[model samples]
Target: MKSFFHVIPVSHVIPANAGILMLVFLGLFCSSFGFATEPQAPRLLEVGVSDVFVPQGFDDNDNAQVVVEGIFPTTCYKLGPVKVDINEDTIKITPQAYFYHGPCLQVMVPYKQEINLGILKAGTYKLNILPDCPENRHTLSIAHSTNSGPDDYLYAPIESARVVSKERPTVRLHGVFSNSCMSLDRVVTHSESNRVVAILPIAKYENNGACLDVLTPFHKDVQIKDPLKGRTLLHVRSLNGTAVNVIEDF
Candidate 1:
């Protein structure tokens, strides 16, 4: 190594202009490490969904919805507005989060968001979740309706739900109705299989008298006596054209 440095001719040495080259190198180095030296503002970034749950089926006039589940790296990350775009046969779903540049706790924050896909013609469609998501492409089938009109009962829109107990778990649901006339009719619990259960809280609307545009809250407690093992999904329907999916592992 000493012989290589010694081989350089004295006349080929860099002149005083080498100061400019050194400054440029230093600028590039600082730019690479600017975050350590300066404060950065919060950024709006997209997070990939871990899982997406779609309802059993949909009709042409029925409202379509899917529940999206994701996780944040830290507690500092807050969930932001979701941007969705549907073009013909494909629906693009982008779940966003707000990342604050400060002291962030090292924890995984799980999140669940519901997206209403609205009505679609009788055909097959694709649900495309944004970049680096698990199973980005999901097939959605919409069947043609032969019924005369829509169903009399609509599912109450649930805000949050949880399993109160593991053994003989009691599912607690809290939601709101659009008007005062709409009330909780009954809680229908259907066990598709051992692990999959669908709870439909049908809302009965009695528009016989004068009804006001009021938001009324409702609560329901569903007891599950059937034996369930492994992963269980409680797909609860919502009146606002959405579904709240609660996944429980026993």
Candidate 2:
């Protein structure tokens, strides 16, 4: 006679280990569901063009003049990195508007509470005091470029650069261009002062499509060349619009 035998599995018999098995399952479930914590990134504050302190920069390609308008918090507050937002219409200034124009405008806010933005472009912006700070101040300026015309076009690109070591020592420039119609008539540099220094052209009328020269950096007023006749190859505006340096034709 065949006798039926009963055999219990070891896993079933070891019921005490069920707790460990449940814990393992629980850990896996937690991991798969992303129960782990993570850190968040900091958000940057946004600023806008509140107003313009000055708006005298010349237009090159479009002969368009830009109006400086600074924008800030309606209430007093700190400041942060300036985010520049521009459109095609607001980007280029028209020649006619140069003579008769309103102030350019923008809005801005502090990314951090400790940041304090001093003077921005003045005539271009309008600000109201906030309860946070009763005394908020700023100024603004413009780096003028020459009026664009057929006779004076094709600005020379900056090919080389050098830093001055002397207190009042002079700096030199050298570069080549694809077109020969342009000349190196002058240069403008931005400095601590708020004036445009006119550096004399060392190499003028370089009809060979390239030129080079040197000029003294002793003047508080710094500007590369004639703004009305030529265009600026390099137009670098400072945090405050009032301070700017231009590399262009006079």
Judging by TM-score against the true structure, name the best candidate: 1
Q: What is the lDDT of residue 4 in candidate 2?
A: 96
TM per model? Answer: 0.64, 0.34
lDDT of each: 0.78, 0.33
- Once superposed on the true structure, which residue ranges of model 2 sit more than 4 Å away at CA? 1-8, 13-42, 45-81, 84-123, 126-136, 141-154, 159-162, 172-176, 180-183, 188-250
Best candidate per lDDT, number? 1
Question: How many residue pairs clash in all the candidates, one count each?
Answer: 2, 55
RMSD of 2: 14.5
lDDT of 1 at 71: 86
Model 2, residue 120: displacement in angstroms? 14
lDDT of 2 at 2: 71
Model 2, 1-250: lDDT tens digits are 8769878798778788898999999989987986754533333443333222222332232221222223344333333333223232122111110111223233433221111233222223222222221222422233233543421333334444332322332344445433344445545443222322322222244445443454322212232332233222223222122222233223
